[model samples]
Target: MAALSPLKLRVEGMDCGACALKIENAMKRLPGVSDINVSYGQESVALTFDEDRTSALTIKEKIRALGFTPISERKDLVAPRSAPVLSAREPWWRGKKGRLVIFAAAMFGAAFAAAQIEPQWSQWAYSAAAVISIVPFARRAFAGAISGTPFSIETLMSIAAFGAVLIGAAEEAAVVILLFAVGELLETIAAGRARAGIEALIDLVPRVAFRERDGVVERISVDDLALGDIVIVRPGDRVPSDGKILEGFSELDEAPVTGESVPIAKQAGDKVFAGSINTNGELRVEISHVAADNTIARIIHLVEEAQGSKAPMARLIDRFSAWYTPAAMAAAALVIVVPPLVFDADWMTWVYRGLATLLISCPCALVISTPAAIASGLAAGARKGLLIRGGAALEMLGKVRTVAFDKTGTLTLGRPQVTDIVPIVGNEGDVLARAAAVERNTSHPLGIAIVEAATARALDIPASFGGAIAVPGKAVTTRLKDGFASVGSPRYAAEQTAPDESVSRKIVALEEEGKTVVVLLSGKRVEGLLALRDEPREDAAVGIARLNAAGISTVMLTGDNRRTADATAGKLGLVARAELLPEAKLLEIADMKKLGPIAMIGDGINDAPALAAASVGVAMGGGADVALETADAALLRNRVTGVADLIELSQATLGNIWQNIGLALGLKAVFLGTTLFGVTTLWMAILADTGATVLVTANALRLLRLGLSVRHSTERNQ
Candidate 1:
């Protein structure tokens, strides 16, 4: 036995969710296949199977035999590929809209001619139109039946059309096929529009790069560029790969990657990403990452994985549909057999009625309603810089009534600066220099701030320190010349040796102003007090206010002292909980869950545990990789307002889904009632089913418009 690997294939000719279900069932029966997921919204199928037992070519051949085209081959299921290809040999009449129009026109022309001709000629005209218009549907239905799925929508439509023809309603049969064709065309267009955002993102990266070597530039594919290779990006061209600018300068528009909506000035030493356009000036960049490893590629891969994971509702619908079709077919059989056998009704009329019931009960619209709306919502959120992990996150975000934030990097800028320093015994420079030496290699923002303050004063920092150790969220200790020294929070220093009255007063004053106070100690004796402050983001208040207006409570959680937390919280008009360690923050999140569903927003490694514990976790895009990977959603622009926007988007998306479901089921109920009675004909039932599909699709598209409006408003405010 061999390990199972995943594969994805872009499928063509899928009009409704029923088609997706049919493909899924057919593929699931194959040996060694597992974890099958098919998304009608994305027109792609994903599955994991043992390569030794099956291969990609075999899977594609199976799909072809099932009456659909598998357009792209997947060597391994990883990143999403480009759109499906249409062979040049494919006839123009095979195009969706063109086929729909041609068949519809033929059906109408034949029906009109039949009504004006002699009775003997009328039969030939109607019969010819029926044969021509129904050929495509008949072929698909035949394929599905032979492939062991006798209850597919195509099969139901074919049965209905053939029944109409037998009952002397050949023109009605032609009209039903024409209308169904038009409906499928509309669905294809809607799905394409929903996928436009992802396609646009994929198109942003250029296929080729201008590599500079030996004082000359040569054009080569992006895949050929290796690390440390120099690439030249002229003005108005997209940066070919992710790298740092080695020479020249430019204003790069990073809106495509970061969703920042601004052009940032970049010079030497500044990092640039692939897919960003150079607005002005030429730039020579040293490639840091190859094409497949770039930021754009990672984003695309994450998005595709997110889209493939099904929501709870979507999975439930799949289960329901699995049985709905077979049961409906059984009911159709009962209508055909019982009414004629039990009531002595005319067999032809009852058979015609049964066929209409079969067509109306295909569950095409019901099966598609949820996924179409969810795909549109996810795409809309991605366009606005919010990367919602999957449908489950989107659905959960809508129910969040309380949002908790990690103060240091989420509510405030992660960068801290030294505000004041008070030396208790040693000279200011001597105290600062010793602290910087001990803190030089630390990743804590406060430690970095101390080192930066000493450097700004031109004090010499030691090249190395011996016996350095960090106590999480407390202090960093190292061996000094005469004795051990430490730089850390006041509580940690107090635990070693209580600070003097004067030093304690200084700490109180600094903390009162929302500054974080740390003590520099030498051998259990206080040397100086260092005050650092990480300012709140400019959009923090606006973001909190927006969440408040939407009736969600906000809380700031931090490891800083109580006074500093209160000061910051008062300024932002939110509640505060301070002096919390990583484990403490996790407990706080657990406690908050009693109030309602809680969402934690943070951008540091310490926030990872709590982020994973919360109902939903949102990470700032620029945060640590651990936090981002642990979070359920990410804000690419690193804006706090994106949190509020995500909430609104989720609410709107869930609402849109319900509306689609209602429209699909409500119309289905009406047509089913009319179908059972003598009031509905085969053509009318087909028209109703088609009309419902179009309405549901159109409703889902409204999310795209809503997304645009939200984006415009965000930009205007910015």
Candidate 2:
């Protein structure tokens, strides 16, 4: 069997979620296709299929046969393309909104002229106007009917308008088609605005880059640039690729990529990402990644994937709509036959009411409600440096009743700093110098802290320590000039050589203040103690407070001692679980799940099992690659406050979705009731359907504004 590869196609002419479902169902009938996901808001379809068994061209032809345009390469899924323009250029009268306006105007003019002519000629004029206005509707309805969706909104409108014309209500039929066309135009415009954020992000990367090679600068397409090539970026220009600054100094505006509101200073040796603007710099950067592998490209790809994944509510709505349209058709048939056959009612009036009921029952607005709000929420979160993996994650985040956090790189900076040093058997500088010599080769944060402290004091490090051996997460042991020297946690040091009473007292006092105390021992005697602390992030308190205020519980899980964990938790007013191994943390997460949905926030490596077990896994950006890849969401700025922002945005988005659904259903119910009472006409029914669609669309668009305001408030609070 050939390996299955993923493909994404930019689809055109999808007006609602039902269209997405139709395309998905049509594509699933093809050979070798799997995991098909189509998004009406993003207007794209993504799927996996065996390349040897089928081809992208075959898939595009199928979509075309289904009455939609597929306008991108299947290979483009390797690096998903930017969202396509809404439509192709056409004559002014053929443009989407413009054509609708022209058709509507023609219908009105024909109606006015018919009112002044003879009755026979008037009927002909009105009939001609209705036919012209209904052509587009009829075409769509015919396509949908053939594609196995015979009860689409277009089909309902076509039936209502044709029914009106048969009853000699040609003027009313013309007006119904005209009003429905206007509603479609408004919906298209609103959807375009909802998609603006993702489009803006895609546009941030410049197409051209200035490459510096052999002491010459040449402009080239960003796609042509290779890794290890140096790119010259000047002031007021967007960085073309992710790279390290080889020379020069300046500040960069990273708001586009990381959501950092302030400009970040960059000099030689500092890393820069693609899509960030060089504010005032003359820098030559060595490209670390090509155009397709850059940070911005990854962000765009993740966001698009997120938009394609449907929420639970969206999936339920999809299932409901499958049955909804067919059931509605049955009810309409009953309305027309039952009343007249059973009660001697007028056939014409009863049939007209049934046609109007069909128009009212179209599920366009309700079908679009959830995905529109979800796409907007995903886009908004991405702009603020929160990459929610899918609509399912977004909805889960809102319901998370408890959030468990890893300590080292999550709530704290993960960079430990030496705060206090005590020499029990030697001078402070001598003890630190000896400890640094043994620790300089270790990569642990505590070891690095000791080495940094010694270097800052200008203490000369010993040139050699004999045959060093490291114990993971515990201590480093080496042979000194006279005997063995061990530098590590107090427990590990005590196991090597018992600490004296004074040294034990000092270590206890430091650990009480939430500091990590490392003991230095030489020849079975305590040399000194170094108290290091990984300071809590500036936003940790605020983020915790915000979660607490929202009635979500917060817990700190760590490998540190109970005293240290308590001290840190007390500062943030959170529950603390200490001295946990990696597996222990996973078990604790399982226990926490009994309370409610759990969200585990970590840097992604050691917390992988726990993250996988939780309701949602949130990874900090710039952490381990495995962690970011495994997480359901990632905070690019590595800020704890992003957790709070994620919850707030999710709640707001879900709220917007419910509002749209209610509005769609409420309007349908009102109009359905009116039609049953004989108070509704063909034009009135179409107007009500169109009006409900517009109202729901406008409500979903409000999330775009809500997302912006939430981001601004987060920045302000920071």
- Candidate 2 TM-score to native: 0.90
TM-score of each: 0.92, 0.90
lDDT for position 227 in model 1: 98
**C-alpha lDDT score of every prediction, in listed order:** 0.81, 0.82
- Stretches of candidate 1 above 4 Å error? 2-7, 48-58, 78-92, 96-116, 124-139, 142-148, 330-351, 621-630, 708-715
> Model 1: what TM-score?
0.92
Q: Clashes in each model (backbone N, CA, C under 3 Å)?
A: 0, 0
- Model 2: worst 10 consecutive residues (lDDT sum): 81-90
Pick by lDDT: which candidate is best? 2
Q: Candidate 1: worst 10 consecutive residues by lDDT?
A: 81-90
lDDT of 1: 0.81
